[model samples]
Target: MRLRHLLSASTVMLGVIVNTTAFAAAPDVVRIGVAQQGTGDPPVFGGSPAATAQLQHRVEDSLKTDGTKVEWIFFKGAGPAVNEALANKQIDFAYQGDLPSVLGRANGLKTHLLLASNVRAGVYLAVPPDSDIKGVKDLRGKRVGIFRGTNLQLVADNVLKEHGLSERDLRVINLDSAASQAALASKGVDAVFLDYNLFKLQRQGLAKIVYASRDGGLQFTRQAHLLVLEDFERAHPEIVQKVVTSVVQASQWSSDEANRDALFALWSKSGVPAQSWQAEYANQQLKDRSSPLIDPFLIARYQAVADDALRLNLIRQPVSVNGWFEPKYLDEALRTLKLQSYWPRFDASGKPIAC
Candidate 1:
């Protein structure tokens, strides 16, 4: 099938009309949902109340002109609960990992991508610090930790394939990030796929990366994005535009060094440790400013995800990139805010120019 047909259809032009109507009947309040990894820290990045406050502040500021009020609804549960809220239309929007986004879309949820956050280049295939394993090919016949149906798992598969190995060649163990990290530290698994933030573990000399995914173009390149239900978008188009605008503004603000203190402060108060907040904050900013601008390249990456998911039997049908994204609202928001100057310059053909 053609790529266009495989992805969601373009609804950019219709988005404006739908959004306008939604704004006209603006509800007294809008409820936004959030998801986060709950196992490790006090205030999770997107799930904790502290992160909620910061988001509320930003969204309120953006929607003030539209006479909209904001309320936050956080889900302490993991992936399944988040999906339930979205399916039930209990919330307006959500910020979640890439794999969940794909799963939600495949399940017929009306979700949209708002922005990318924290494109860490450090996801690795790690073994106990003392392990003799040296590369992806070394994992054959060994137990490997992975969270199935996730970006990490997909990347793990890609990396092994590149090394002439397959999942069938290893004993695959299913575990979440937190669990996988612990299993690696205890030497319970021969090798585990993990994010760079596990540097804390590496500092203790408990683990060492057998293969660095970033350098090999095999890293998950995970993106946390904001998504809203289709009915919500249809009901409150103007509000959705405001939400998108707020996200763009927040992303831009997050890129500034002076803003780092305030960002960390918010994160720290939300239950994240000061040190961890600092690390994640810096990583998110670096990604926001320097990562590949969202365009055809990203669309292709999403397609790759769809293809891989199908091969793994994770999802039943192929998904197209076009129908999944509606960039018109973003463009509209940028133009209305006259914040075009804040965005990187692109040619008439929509190619980004080097600064």
Candidate 2:
């Protein structure tokens, strides 16, 4: 069974591998960009476009003519690459991380935060297994690896702040995820801001997790959004609605308890290994984390993120967080699909806002 394939015990502890929308006169091909999906050779359960891609086919087939095509773009450069694509009006929808999407808006790429793809993603700090850095503060003056301009940077900075430290207090070395992992292996950096993949390094005894935001607070965790270009949305509301409908449908399937094993297996194609998903999702409810609702909680958090980014000089001009959301599409999708109560809504601090 596909579900059984996803839950194979040997796959659990091992290490491996590893949006948008809008409309014009319905372009010949609809380009969907996955900012964090670098080439997506090995599917990652975290935020892969696999589920949505399948859902997209159905939506497109029913909503458009046979000539219409769906084109997916995966960028290894992550958010920045997608941001560039969106800016050039090459991408209609973008499933992207919080920080880059925020910066994109601040830089004048018009997009509506349609539905949230994911929330409460964890950030990890990995240090050499033999290092004396017992906690965040211990590395104040030491070298720290951060993939600058990515959401991980903010998560890392926020974690540091929680420990009464700041990026200013440390020698911040900018490195991409792979390079940072390698740096940690070579002891090139005292610590590297990373994610669930930290487990692989731990298995290798190359690094150890010093801090993580896996506990109950949403603000402490990284967030991702599903966004659509404003121009496209303005041009074809019908297509945008269909896209939102499909996303909601996919979200519904994803939230179902019975599909857990199959869903994880689908994500295992990213070379992350099925077991890695099991470990990462241990004790966590899939629905609680993947709600597609564009609730106030995300809006408030983005406002706070924008405020902090302004203070931190991550963006030139202030990003209008409130304007980022155009919830009508999601609202309609939920209502039409009878899924209004399917996904719980939360406040910006991540508390369930009674539906």
Candidate 3:
């Protein structure tokens, strides 16, 4: 009888130990890597659903009860640099663009796509103030600056292709945003492909805006997403769910059309002017750009990006978009928050589909 009692106690203690071990699996710190830097000294970014989460402290608030610290590490080198940090295990989650993320996956980084953080960001073509280059065709034989290895590169190359030009036809210089802007200011490069940030150069009288992607249509834009290192997600899925939930909450808030002014106000902390954000999103519905759903449109776009990368020799091996996404967390969050139909779904061609 005493032996049986002792065994019962031992079993209870073993169960307690196992439960404690499970609880302890949650890390004390969660590091998230951001692909680009914010404008100011303290460094905050805006313009995406993930950015909205950061701005609103959604993730931090979600994890705080567990005594977990959330750290947002921004990389000025953009997605490529974020990929390096992911390889080093310095970060568990990342907000990165399509190409660099695909490149990382092709190179053997294990991560699962969690959510579509942002999409359909337009591209811009800017030239020196006095240059006569008026269109993409005129870029042939000219010194063009592009941030190579970024999502920008593939689209820029395609834009060139559409105009009967190629990277081979131009003196292509690999430059990041700041360097490209400086090169344009110094007239070191004849033209630079940029995003909405190009407006800053035009406002400063440093560059001329020749082409805006919005003028061409939706196909001209690029996409980005929130992802988690597979190891981390496998180890602490609860924490991953919390993070995804917070981002979805932020996306919901950001997608509300009534919060337009308030949303820009929050984003302007990144040192971009409120007017710039306003102009960037002008005549556009907030819900379309801020949706967190990994719908058919997003999947198709990523697959297309992967194909383009392989065909352009941008990635050595084919990065399959299939099984790359883990959407259960997102789906669960939408269900839990009752936001299943909050954001509209889009088809592969960017057209809205009924729920």
- List TM-score per model, in order: 0.76, 0.86, 0.94
lDDT of 3: 0.90
**Candidate 1 stretches greater than 4 Å from native:** 1-25, 38-56, 60-81, 119-122, 218-220, 257-293, 341-355
Alpha carbon lDDT of residue 304, candidate 3? 89
Of the candidates shown, which would achieve the greatest lDDT relative to the real structure?
3
lDDT of each: 0.65, 0.76, 0.90
- Residue lDDT tens for model 3, 34-62: 99976666578998989999988899999
Instruction: Give the count of colliding residue pairs in each prediction.
Output: 8, 18, 0
User: How much does candidate 2 score in TM-score?
Assistant: 0.86
Q: Alpha carbon lDDT of residue 91, candidate 2? A: 88
TM-score of 1: 0.76
Error of 1 at 324 (Å): 1.7
RMSD of 2: 14.9
Please give the lDDT score at residue 352 for candidate 3. Answer: 90
lDDT for model 1 comes to: 0.65
Please provide, for model 1 over 32-105, each residue's C-alpha lDDT reduced to its tens digit, 9 standing for 90 to 100: 66664532333235322224334448788877776777766655454546788889878778766566677778
108 Cα displacement, candidate 2 (Å) = 1.3
